[model samples]
Target chain A: MRDDEEMGRITLAQVAQKAGVSISTVSKVLNGRQDVAPPTRIKVERLLETHAYRRTARSSREAPLIEIVFHELDSIWALELIRGVENVAKANQASVVLTESGTRHSPDPDWIEGVLQRRPIGVVLVFSALPQAVKQQLRARSIPFVIIDPAGDPDPDVPSVGSANWTGGLAATRHLIELGHRRIGIITGPEDMLCSLARLDGYRSAMSMAGLETAPELIRFGDFHVEGGYDRAMEMLSLPERPTAVFAGSDLQALGVLEAARVNGLRVPHDLSVVGYDDVQVARWSSPALTTVHQPLRQMAEEAAQMLLRLRTEEPSSTRLELATSLVVRKSTAPPRAD
Target chain B: MRDDEEMGRITLAQVAQKAGVSISTVSKVLNGRQDVAPPTRIKVERLLETHAYRRTARSSREAPLIEIVFHELDSIWALELIRGVENVAKANQASVVLTESGTRHSPDPDWIEGVLQRRPIGVVLVFSALPQAVKQQLRARSIPFVIIDPAGDPDPDVPSVGSANWTGGLAATRHLIELGHRRIGIITGPEDMLCSLARLDGYRSAMSMAGLETAPELIRFGDFHVEGGYDRAMEMLSLPERPTAVFAGSDLQALGVLEAARVNGLRVPHDLSVVGYDDVQVARWSSPALTTVHQPLRQMAEEAAQMLLRLRTEEPSSTRLELATSLVVRKSTAPPRAD
Candidate 1:
């Protein structure tokens, strides 16, 4: 029994060394990353199974369970996204592990290492803007995974899931436009984020569609947080020719916009029309109820979890899933009048 | 090299078997959990060191990491509580592992086993109404843990951290009394929770202090959710002798109160005053900012994490730490008007 236990505990590095492949290739095989060649992948996988095969905590004797790795970046928005993911994981009986990629000051590598060492059937990368080099490392290891909101370009073969961010942005802009607002302003997330760019594109597209010129002064940047939104809104509202309508990239930012409006004695929809994206729970409860675009957060999370599960099970990857978005017309938005 | 690798991998289970002790005793020795006799504990520790026994992951190499297990009871309010815990855990350089305790229908023991096998330095239980038998099991294992908003009495030695619920209730009720409100209502959380009981006690105490009679019709039962708060608030307001002020146990519930007020055409602080507990982020942003008892959520989480860390480190367990609470005067509360 002791000998069996000792021999059964094979580290991935040892398997990689013995197979005359990079640790990544061995990882790719173990993770069922489909980019690898069939013969080489099979050989490595066979070796892995023979050496350290262990069923996942959720899996039956035959089926392997994928693990969803949630890296919460200090945001309450992550919680809603997690609920969406957990709902899907529970339905599928796949195991999910939640961890925080420590705050910006001290980025610990232990979280990543722990997930890798666990050798989960597959992984779902949730809200991780992992550096390119780290992403490359993960790819090289051929860790079967799908990025929900990855910082980099999506792999052609690996499945990815996200909302129709650009459309949502356009919808938010159009809502203000339909309210007869020409002098519309926009507050967006960090410029580096893909969603931020996509949302901005949507806003510009909507403005152009209305034959309205974009006002350079009306645009501002926020870090996709309530405080960031609040500060940026303050800056925008303080301008000489303040915008009549404000489009915020997130609901939290919209709240900030509301606060800024209140501080400036601007009545919502009466003095300032505001539209927000990601219509999180706060949107419905906030006073004047935020007019916003609803990101199919739950659907996106569920699809991503399913995609990761398929990858872990060595099933064929599905095409990228782009969920739809819709505008939830609420009291926060109104037509701009000649005040 | 293979033989050396094999020789170095000695699981604690092996050490426990060899030393003729329970896995709990071996774990206690490894983690320095001090309930065990000094001699037996030292014997196990010596065996582990002599054999060069290593924990499965490198997590063991670092100072013990604590886990804040969120017993997700399908309540959104838990999200803010988690945020509080995460903030503290991050500040302390301790990693938090989030796990969903099964709901009423799916009670699985595997969740507990998974956390235990990981050998977390300690655990911070949040809002989990764990059964007494399970608590006994945890106690028997001698795992150092702290329960936050626990549903039942924890082992005497295991420390707990929570807000001053009784005081919060009193503060809310007194705020109403000062407003010349004779008929005030209360919306409470689940009957089984200790916090709910404390909050009820405070409300009763405040009414007694004010020489005001408690109206049976004014008290309503809620599940500490927005919908529950909303329904209960509606019920209270519909009464012939309606309450002039309503104190809710949670912010989510308070939101429901606001909705109820809106539906009933009641102007806040004009016709009805509302006070809520645990001033979550939404409380500040709500239309008429909520007048709430600010439960030091972040501080409570930090204190709980600190307590768990101390317990895991073989330090003497301190008696329960009761964090302070304060009443945040906001737009939601005001003096009751004479009809």
Candidate 2:
């Protein structure tokens, strides 16, 4: 479907005529100018999408730029992703244009206009899902984009990069089980996220395989942030029979668990054991450091950027690339004390 | 001198003639084209510099881009600074171009070429100093730039924004002193950086003011990283008469100190008190949380970005702006336990 332009089957004039608009108006719409009325713009966009009109490769005279859009720039994961894209862009002698826009689902509507006008080599979106309209707009302009979907929910049509969440969860739980912890708790991400559910299922599988009971009271959902981890940990700690070990979903959440334990007068790895996912820099820098799942965020971003560059020249072999997640043994996890 | 171009005191043709180069050659140099010979490029550059040939204000037709160049994007402060610039750039409806280039002192020579062609609205550099040649090129092209100097080293001629390192040092020290800590040690940054010296001095002042002798063994210069903090802290903790509290000069260093104390079987704020500088995210995320100095890194970057915009329309009222730092008391510090 993306190759219709390779056959030279569509032209701007044809799209303009079909949309009942002037060639200049079509050009304006293509450039994302706001002057065009909504109706006309929608009509032109539909025509372009139907024809799959891919813009020609950018001229060499323009400085090569790669655009990376993030819904939330404040995320702890932002730096790793930016560095990944930056690494690839630098290697290609291209600069990175960063935009913080939109919700977790898609970029803001206004963002597309600037992107169209800039005519970057490609775009890398740190979003779980791309709005269909936005996807069509980018596809019509031949702006190849790949989503760095750390959330593990990949749209089948869009090329995406994610990590092995289930494997990460299985390994984390198995490590604790091997250390002779029978009653282990799991604090996964929001219930709505696929990664969280995947991790939870992995934990449940590990517990069942080890002949241990999966107690409902020992399972919880978290916001994947520090405060949420602390709150959930405190609740479990107050239980009459609290779990001896916990898998704290994300590194930020893991820090909260560490703090919660401190507040509860329990020493990490001695009175309680905590494991975090996402081996972000903070994982290593945390007080006792954290035993975490290495989600390969940077490598995932690098792969996404590389995939965008690849899509520009050739058809992708696969639309989804799920990298492996490994366990990192640090200071946070240990055997539960004898009664 | 910057107003010479506004007064139309120089022309490209005249500069080309003076340099004995063709107008086209001068134009290529202006565009940062690499085809020109070294001698010709330098000759044309000198003539342009002599005449103060500021390129006319960029055409509004071009995309408004704000460039931010960092020598090391891996620094923990990078995110805060990027957020600050991103905040301002978004407000102005300008996209941000991020470049990781050069060293701590200046950007690489090749970096200027792309900047020349991109012709961003302005540039915000995250470096302690800019080479004379790079400064000349930027000035000749009328591309205003401001440095975000967290290192506390500001070139006299360049507009820069920095924080009050000395004051931050004083605040952290006084917080410890007020907590009844008579014997305190400090782990400041590298000895060469002015900020490190300033912070060390602040610690010294606080100690002297409290009628305490500043022991040579208690003051240690560190690399301002976690490992450095850990090594120095271990050395200090091993002293015959160890400090009751330690002031770690940076958040990363403070993390190291926490680990060191843990290894020594000393509880934070109980067996030992610890205070950190730079209240970065990690400071708050650490097990006990760190009592530290709040360096307004994001604000400093915002000011630098704001300064660049102001430079486009008017001369800066002051070339150097130093934001204040304050103390943030958290869980890390307490009165020294009775020996």
Candidate 3:
């Protein structure tokens, strides 16, 4: 039993080396990415089955299972991630178990122990970090875990899946800039989160490139919800020199900003242009329809689940996977009106 | 060990019978629902713990755990339910384990078997049913389960938690009528769902009570989403004599109705009035802030979680728990005008 456990530690690199194919090629097949040639996909799949032969020798019929741990099921964001994970989970016949981390930035040791007891093939943590103690213990048990949008700085050992926040921020800011808006205000997420910092940095860079000075007062930090967006945008719009345009870090926040605009008697696209990030479900449903940056949260989550599965059953590949972002122009943005 | 296992199966009736208190009084203490006299509460709690003093003899340090099973993690609706369950789960020092039943409405035997293997204290099924075979297996093992908003007829054997949908529909339509609107249109959920039929029935009764002839063309069956709501409302509005007010079965559908109105250049509450159900997070944020029936989905979920915990550890209460719903009049409805 101990020897079989040792064999379970086989890495994705080792499988690729043995199969005489690149690690990426092996990953495409395992993730059901559909980009790989059929023959190569077949060969890689055969090798993966053989590699897990000992484990499946007991029973080939039962589907595999994985675990997804979230810090909180706070918003629509969580639903999008769950949808992505389910898409892949269904196709692979692998179940996803959800457990909340209960507001602690570092997970409770007892919760980690419970996960260890379940012995899921792999674990995916969303907007979460692994404390040193828990990380050491997970490694000792030979269980693979991946982080999605880590709360802190990226650690070399932890694999992660996230969208390009900086690029998204840059695109949103540039859209406002090109539309003849110079006095642009930005509402970013919590300062400590990596994605928040990246988005803030992206906004600063765009302002600098446009030869515009980013006023310190124009930037506000928020919790990425409607209330925070409304509060911060109220302050920005209340200033003696109100910005003609605003960029919000989340769709929820942008809706709040719109509320702020309505309360202040400012018309969207006619008096003020607004841009939101993370084109969540209600963005299109909102009146005037929000123009925003598209963050592929669902696809990113699917990739994360796929990555964790590979790490558990096959071998580890290159650690970080950053999905690209794009700008989606809708009815909410337009050129600032003449004074 | 076997003796302790047997003791674990001790029913709440057995506890109440020994404690010399009514089963309901004992239940109040077990669920921490305050109202019992201090002396009675203390006496019941003591007896409850002493009944299986041996169970605590093993270790009472670890918190108890419960399971919540969902049909699919597809919508904001699911997250609200999760949040409600988590609130009670946290207060009771009980952790929640979430499992998705996927496409199969009635869970597979294997899935039920896997849950049984986990040995959870109780289970909460959201919009799900158990096959007779699986139900028998669960009962034989003494594991308790409750259904929340069951999709089919209310089964006597299965305890369930839900809101008063008929009352909600009545309240919404009555609000429109009292606003001086004689002609009202209704859009309901899927035909097979009990809530759908109830809401539709409620609409018919309200129209009858008003001595108004019900128009078959004005009532439409929808899937309870934006697209369906929009399509049905569009159809109703295009009629030669359109209704002055529309009542949508869900907030999503209301948004669809709003979209239809916008496309047709009708101003809400001025040219027409709209009322929605479910009052999800986005309703308050929508343009004109939707008038809706508060379904209490989150509170209903909390009550369901609390009920499941009680069913497992205490004597079961009367089977079905129906929470009350109310109307939240926002900006979407008003008196009809004389053009």
Candidate 4:
């Protein structure tokens, strides 16, 4: 299975001729050499993409590596994802290369150069979208990649692993409803994220299914942070007819809700019940603990890494895999107080 | 300078000759090939160690990697330290290789083999002690290593980075004392670790300086976890003469203390002031935040990684560098009631 012959597509020689460059020059551009002229590099790159050239599988002597890239390494989800990838890498006798680069949508352009030079076994990205040029470059080198898209937005052609945000939202709302609460408030995440919208929709569906009228004032958008949760919860708590319970969207936001409840002289699970999303470590450490939706973030990372390995060997069974989310009952939620 | 030509040290040829093996076999053993016979490998290893054999520095074309190994990846400290090394790696155009391998004192034998093959620019270990054999293996490969020892126990000869544990403890206790906490309980970390002893000594010194009688019943040893804090705090709160405040040795333990106070129907700060150590992210996320000591974990990691880079080019000025710790006043501590 040689790379140049497998697809029966136009070979590198034809692409080199089309781009008016020597085969060696085309090879230099493919290998990410800095000596190639910028215009010639661009032309060769276009031809490679057009021809869908795939390099042969790397030799066995190459250093075994699995690269994981994240836009924001400070997120609480980072450790779990890293651990998951590390586990698989160890099992395969591969080292894990970590990089915090680029914006939320994709990794920085410079990052691709390092990956090309390293010639890692595969890459696992924690972003929702990747630019076409980046995708083309990775494909041209036969370096497989999979996205761990927690944001619930995935490109149709890309392989991705995500959790069921909508079901999580529904499960959380239903738990509160079952606890005899009718005036329910929700502080969903940022409006731009698809996962946030999905969760919000799930909350609305749950409320409507239970024959409860959701007031527009009870619905608010948060930034998935403690301060955002605090501000939104404070506003909702100050209402003339405050809700008995609130869904704080994320664990950080729920922590803010707990503080807001404390500021208003309300004890958790006694005066007001609160539910959180993403059962991160803090969920268990919070003073009263927290009743949250358990998103399989670590498992998602493992699956994404596994998908990359599978892509290296053969075609994957599916382009997208969505794991289920479940509700965890902790001390934070209970029946509303009878006043 | 070439490795064999430097320092007038014994060369690989001498090592292999003494071990009664071929030069190629000794080279295979150095590169971590698994095909060598166990007896032959052991003999070759001993010869190399006795001679202090060092290989040539890796070629410039080799993959740019900086390795960081941890025995436990779940600690709250992991994220910050990873970020620190990642920051430096990015600036230097190098990628970080992360591994969760080995025990509390040293990495597993299998880990060094991969590190050898990867030929990282250097390694940053998060353990208190490493075996002589592992150290020799790394040195022979010319792979510089530095320890990020928060444990406060470090090998005198190895370059290491650590923070001031004793000072951190003293600062935390002094802050509580200044807030009118005369009878302060202290729950330091596990007894076996030097850091635990140092912090406890600091607490004792602070109490003695303040002319306060250190009650034997008020002092305890914890496991640096939330549950240990909760258990110890619960016991203290149940005492016939409970202290007005408690010094939780770690933020995780401090979280435990807060929960224990809640279970006992005591209000934090108002009824019993609390102070925590190692102001990790959870310290700020905890409700009412936490009045704790900032351990500078990220900075320590950065310094350790930088030390490795320095060792690669030239000798480090010092074998050990200890950063200072300071108290952060949050909402967790306040003056006790005059009742």
List TM-scores for all candidates, in order: 0.71, 0.97, 0.74, 0.96
lDDT string for model 4 (A1-339, tens) is: 986467557677988899998999988887777798988988888777666677765678656899999999989889999988988888888889999999999999888888888888899999988888788777766678998998899888788899999999999999999999999999999999999999999999999999999999999999999999999999999999999999999999999999899889888888999999999999999989999999999899898888877777685343889999999999999999888
How good is the docking of model 1, by CAPRI class? incorrect
Q: What is the C-alpha lDDT of each candidate?
A: 0.70, 0.90, 0.76, 0.89
lDDT at position A229, candidate 2: 98
Enumerate the chain B TM-scores of all models. 0.76, 0.96, 0.80, 0.94
Query: Tens digits of per-residue lDDT for model 3 on B1-339?
Result: 786686675666776787787888766554344477867756665565445422211124333557777777765478888778878876775666666674535654445645544455677777544566555545544567787773334656678888888888899988898898888999998887888888888888888898888899999999887889899999999999999999999898898898788778787878889999998888988877899999887887888887877765575544887888899999899999888
Report residue B62 deviation for candidate 2 (angstroms): 2.9
Task: Score candidate 4 by lDDT.
Answer: 0.89
Query: Weakest 10 consecutive residues, lDDT, candidate 2 chain A?
Result: A1-10
DockQ of each: 0.18, 0.82, 0.19, 0.77
Compare the candidates by TM-score and give the number of the best one: 2
Best by lDDT: 2
lDDT of 3 by residue, A103-199 (tens): 5355554566555445567777774556765555455445678777733355566888877888888999999999999999999988878888898
Clashing pairs in 2: none
Candidate 1 TM-score over all chains jointly: 0.71
Angstrom error at residue B63, model 2? 2.1
What candidate 4 gets wrong by more than 4 Å, as runs, is A1-6, A9-14, A37-39, A50-52, A316-318, B1-6, B9-11, B37-43, B46-54, B316-318
* lDDT per residue as tens, model 1, B1-339: 786486675677888898899898887655434478867865776676556564544354333345555656235545655656666665665445556566632235555555545556667776444565345434434456777752333345547776677888898889888878888899988887777888888999999988888988887779887889999998988899888889988888898898788778787778889898888778887757789988876677777777776665454464667777889989888888876
lDDT, ranked from best to worst: 2, 4, 3, 1
